[model samples]
Target chain A: MNGTEARTIAAPDLLEMCAAHMRAGGRMQMAYVWFPQAGATPEIRYLASQGANQPFALWCCRPQPGEALPSLAKISPLLGWYEREITELGGVHFDGHPEPFPLVLHEGARSTLPPLDPRYPADQPVEFEAAPWRIPELGGKDVQLLPFGPVRADVLESAQFLFFYIGEGIIHYYPRLFFKHRGMERRFQGLCPKLGTVLAERVSGVGSVAHALAYCQALEAAASCQIPERARWLRVLLAELERLYNHLHYLGYLCHTTTLKVGEAEGRLLEERAKQLNAKLTGSRLLRGIIEPGGLRRDLDSAGLSDALEALRREFADYTARLERTDSHLDRLISTGVLTRKVAVDQGATGPIERASGLDRDLRRDHPYAAYAELPMTVALREAGDACARMQVRIAEIETSFALMQRVLLLLPAGPVRTDCHPIAASEGLGWSESPRGSLYYAVHLDQNGKLARVKIKSPSFSNWRAFPFTVHDSNMMDYAINEASFGLTTAGCDR
Target chain B: MPLWTFFGLTRGTATTAWPASGADNGQTGVLGMPRHYPDRCQDDCDACAAACLPGAIRVHTEASAGARLDVDYGRCVACQLCTEVCPAGAFAPSTDWAFGVRARTDLVWAAATQTAPARALSGMIRSTFGRSLHVRHVDSGSCNGCESELQALNNPFYNLHRLGIFFTPSPRFADLLLVTGPVTYAMRAALVETYQAMPEPRWVMASGTCAVSGGVAEGGYACAAGLEGILPVDVYLPGCPPNPAALIEALLLLLGRAPQRIEGGRLAD
Candidate 1:
């Protein structure tokens, strides 16, 4: 582990150690069961970090036969999703786990063995029968339930939402997402590191560069390959470019939710321009097929990037200023879908969602990936934790992203963009990047043949999705879409 | 004056005059699909096939044919790994982005003589719903790339609604069922239910490489090989995530409002 510390501890000591780590202000980033060889006991790994310039601390353990591991969900609520996934996919049991239910697999989906188990046949299909979502029973007068999606209104990702609302006000909200889970992590198994970047880029289309950067950096660490200076700076540029478009789209989509048609059109037009800039710089509108393990797949011409940045800076200023002064949009967002600071930290909120809740943690400044360590970066924060606060945080971040991109272009070094990278056998590494949404991590484990043994993705949306229902539980139905747009959560990221 | 109105006037019109001949579809100097040049392929070379993660390019060997490259553009995600790894320049980087076609057979390329591609939509479909097309998009399992582009279609730059194409929330009112992703097992039933709900004259368009032939996640544990074997796909537009312009072109081509630029897996002038 290049920038992390790994410890092998007894399975029983896991909970106590994790509690101590949390007390020391470290946040749990990822927890997954790693299956090495056939018939071998599954190894559970817990990764945590205190953010910014702190090395990741990973604790690994293997439970004894029939010994159920103590759940970490009590200490960190977000680990419930991880533990539920571990149970359904890895067949691991956690004692005293709250809300012990199938997280990834639907009710009627069947498999002879856990899909993550090495003994499970890859060719065998996991048979699925369309089963009704297990929405909880909440008894209250006038609290009628309305089940929306897997197929939702407008061009939204598939996820079912059970709204237990009293007329227009929501009493309880239960979301059943992951309808778009394409076995992304499992697809990485047996793939060469070169092709792994391709799959990673498609993990979340909008977060293509961030995902690719994280995946490539993981492999790069495994190979002990130092990417060229130009490539690192270029990575920063591309990442910021992605952030620019995503934030712009978020703003536009938020407007769509608020019924601000003119604002929506303007924001989308700017987003389209930003995408065109991406196309001009990297040949891919979504900025895919450009990044690889060692470095960039090809060199980018920065000649036009600066000119585009200048034009965008002027246009974005006008857009955001108008948005801030707009009373109707601000009024709708001000106190709508409020998530307090304590709940954000407890539910493991990352990215802008956590930032809006007044948690001043940013991986770019904290973990310092790519060229972020060298580049001057600022973290945007807001205390309100409402839709308006989330919008303001994104607005500030868009400004920061623009500044960062400009700086990268100014200081981009001249060198070969790529290096010869070959994965080392039986090597593994952890890589993280501050994606447009939040901290995205890729854990790569290579087999004996230098092929990917297993890859676990911790997408920011996965963390934020766990934190989303908190805001909707007592909110109104009218503000639900606005709240969601403000958070900018994607089901693909969560499902993957 | 209202701030929006003032800004709108200053920015002027951002819409592109595409689908009306010689307009920039906004995809300039962009790499589309990899153009397969079998003539330039070196003997005993399998670099392109090995590099292709989606198995879009395969080398089929037979006693009569010896060895030949079989390329299915439908399966290509346009990663361009083939173009990079091919030492012989067998696969060239191309900008021939407009690949929307009526028949699935039009997307598969072979070293042998190609079969004729399908004709335009029937007179009933053309005459009945040529001017207006209502689409119901289902994300069986996408990375949200297709959805991002789909949303962009409504942006001022593209404004697909100006061409009489609208995304309807209800499948019952839709004339076209646009499907994206690899048709993940979890989303299959929902996709089917949506198609079943569409009116009798409904058509299905497999939008994106994942929808066309599952792209990279094809045949994985969670998903099938896209909409091909699952549903009757009338229009197949393949891209990792097609740009907004490509989506508009595909929708128009489906309504028989535009010509099918790709035939037998080759882009025609």
Candidate 2:
């Protein structure tokens, strides 16, 4: 979207105008498609936004039933996943999709009804289709295939990785995940308004605050409800805390993967402290239950967080200094599993991954939500596009988040924590927010009863997962673990 | 390496003393299973159940029997919604950490009078695996909430190995099957196959509420709620995703090392 406001476009010019807009330097922010209960035709709206002066062109396309929808994946490979997602969920087929595969509803079981379809048989069994999406492989005679997991020794999320290798180095790897699909989006439709906030927090457990904020943002937008100023500041406070803890844990895990014991230990300790701090601030370690629609669930003392965060920031810099000084850590990360800027931009990578590749896109700055505009922040940037660069970006971001949090705490406005949020029946709205990893979004359509008719979530993981195959290509098989860890892709989020 | 080594030495150990002493864990606040008080429930009130996302809390009201509220902890995600919505304060926050039991019935804190108190494991079964326990974890369909705490078990603080609990890489070597997540249809075969791969005398511990009663994804068309019919679970440790401390308590209870502090939803005095 070019400007700050949203501009509506007719159904016919959805794809062509979007292509032209992008040609005119517009960015394809997200494409949200949904099934309207009363009608057979699905509503497809593509939000193309970029730059300060440009308005976000909301291209609402109504693809006639059985006709193939125009594919944006052909023009921008970044939208392949989104286009494929629309196909699987909205039951709209997009012509010219590079690889149109089922991202969530996999093939293997008995053929079942389309999960989110209005005509879906609720009582019927979810059987697999006769010919479902299959994992395809690129071949070479010298290449040997090795499978990694849907299950592993560690408490890793269930995801299978098939590494096509020639000798010790991988030529390419196909990751087959979503063995953890819990029909979350389907359940969201059936959830009560009050319960939506609770489950939204659990969308990708670690990003609870971000997801909750996104869900609430969508609800508030639909209802046109304004939360208290204090509530907005609290949201920022909790979000930054969530970011701090996740980055610590992610950094620590990356170190562990690379055999940097000291870095790993420091990361764990810092993450633990962050969790404890969160518990003290919000009554839960991961900051759950503190956020919901309208405002917070209840209020607690945030006074201690600033001091703890300051201490953490100081300690973090010292630990990172020691970490960077180590040759073993640096050697393993430097150019290991490099992702090019081209691949990142093409695949629409966000957060540290994009920043590491020199894209410098942080949704918090680009599209400010919550109290981000009030508490101004800087976007952390790096250009190496390596695992090390990703780590550097994360470390830098942690410091920035800490500083931002201190400012938010000092300048917090006092008011009510929560208020009544009533959504209008037969209304639809979009909510987007910057999570620890990247931009997280949710598109919700309410029924006549003011209940959720459908909710299509586009988590950061969904966009970032496309970069994985590119990242691991031709890299040493041993570096696979490091590459995976560096991306911080959540299998649960992707599967959802 | 020397500087880091020095830093590590100065920082010292961060391990917690749980089974040995007091293990401060992720147990405080609105995180664990709610302690339901049926007696305190408002007459014909369905607030908590109505507020429940997965229908974990059920209120059945008949003219003759009046109203009865039953909480299936396995289905509850510990969102503390029940605590917030219950006007009667029927659902209160609790500190009952040692929640593991051999029977699934033990996980149910009901509105009706208890018929069967959960019995300890059979002497023959306990004796077969008396010395130590090796767990093989299966991500049946977890959101990684349970997996995070499970990973914490290996971190510097918990050090689950100290308690003679080790996570094995293979089901063949595993003495106990520790499963997380609601049993999704995609993983149904994998779950059964993993159990099949395990040797005889292998016990099963349904770790989270999802494994025991399917948490929030209970009865979806694509997934099975809980592991009730799928497998015979020995230890039903119910929590949305039980904290590491709770897991420690659960394991200790399995070994008859820690006292079972919870019974019928409340802390047994």
Choose the strongest candidate by lDDT.
Answer: 1
**Model 1 TM-score on a 0 to 1 scale:** 0.98
Two-chain DockQ for each candidate model: 0.77, 0.60
Query: Each model's TM-score, in the order given?
Result: 0.98, 0.95
In model 1, what is chain B's TM-score? 0.94
Candidate 1: misplaced stretches above 4 Å? B111-116
Residue A420, candidate 1: how far off, in angstroms? 1.2
**Model 2: per-residue Cα lDDT over A1-37, one tens digit each:** 2123565555456567767876887677677666776
How do the residues B212-237 of candidate 2 rate in per-residue lDDT, one tens digit apiece?
88777776666786797999887888
Per-residue alpha-carbon lDDT of model 1 for B74-191, expressed as tens digits?
Answer: 9998999999999988899998777898878788874443644555354567888868989898999899999999999999988988998898999999998989999988899899
Q: Quality of candidate 1's docking, in CAPRI categories?
A: medium
| Cα displacement (Å) at residue A173, model 1 | 0.3
- Tell me the tens digit of each residue's lDDT in model 1 across A1-496: 6688889988778889989988988888889987888688888888888566878898887887567899999999989999998888888899999898777988888888888876777656688887765669898777798989989877889999998988889999999987888888888888888998889999999999989999999999989999999999999999999999999999999999999999999899899889988887888999999999889899998887787898998989988999999999899999999999999989999999999999999989887888899978889999999999999999999999989988988888899999999899999988889998999999999999999989999999999999999999988989898998999999999998
